[model samples]
Target: YFFRDPERRPPDLPGAVVAPADGKIIDLSLVEAGPVHDSAARKVSIFMSPFNVHVNRIPVEGVVKALRYSPGKFAAAFQSKASLDNERQYVDFAGPYGRVGCVQIAGWLARRIVCHLRVGQAVHPGERYGMIRFGSRLDLYLPPECDIRVKLNDRVRAGETIVGVLHETK
Candidate 1:
């Protein structure tokens, strides 16, 4: 069954929600850990294979605040440097809960990262937002202090797995 199916069974737990892309978790870095503009984020990278699903979904319910499209060389997304050197689309969404960021990276031979939502658009958790036409990677950057539940290289189903618990700051 494909993700984003209207008839799909709903999840039974509470958290930020599952990942939005189909791939293996390649890296999890707790970058700058701390408030909004002053706060840092944890970067989780999912490497998509050509044989995996190419569509993406929203990991949490929120409203799109801004969209930044970066034009760069199309590199193999699984490579260590792809996250830095490849073309990418960065989207920032702010919910009543917190801020969440999504990054779509273009892989070798895959030149497009199509984001179909606009600024101010509201999105539901697990809702289809856009896709990387062929194969690429999706990075979910979360606020620091989030308690993650998934492991590196773990196989995850978009919309069906819980990757983290959106922690409440003390």
Candidate 2:
């Protein structure tokens, strides 16, 4: 169903950002942003209801640096600690302009996370990297310096929403 969207294609675009997964954005916070790729990083939590599309896409163009897979309990992903304790994958991407991160989490009822890209793999913007079977969540770790254009409780369409700007890295 998600493949039918023509805007989901990958290409170089100025100030063009896409959703990392198909779901509803439930929570947003201004946390301690990371360096470089995550300079002005704002943390966004996306809750994928069972009825929503399960496919996940890359928000920007970049190469995979490292994949951190941690095993944990299948708690609900809406909680704050769920991001720290849930079974998820930490994907780091390096791009020409900057770097970014994506966190795929398993919800209480969902238990599978399929990551299609490997370390050193070059993925384009809006490319399908993997999926979370059943209900799930995706966290976008953005640069702290980037301008957050969305708000909490806002419904964002994956592959079509511009969550934030990709600031030019020094």
User: For candidate 2, what is the lDDT?
Assistant: 0.77
RMSD of 2: 2.9
Clashes of each: 0, 9
**Over all chains combined, what TM-score does candidate 2 have?**
0.87
lDDT of 2 by residue, 1-105 (tens): 532334465445665557787677887776776322434567888888887777888887778988889899888877777787889988988886577889899
Candidates' C-alpha lDDT? 0.77, 0.77
Candidate 1, lDDT over the whole model: 0.77
Give per-residue CA lDDT, model 1, range 35-116, as digits (tens). Answer: 1224688788898887778888888777998898889888789886887788989888777557878889998967878899
Q: After superposition, how far is residue 4 of candidate 2 from its true place, in Å?
A: 10
- Per-candidate TM vs. native? 0.87, 0.87
Off by over 4 Å in 1: 1-10, 33-38, 168-170
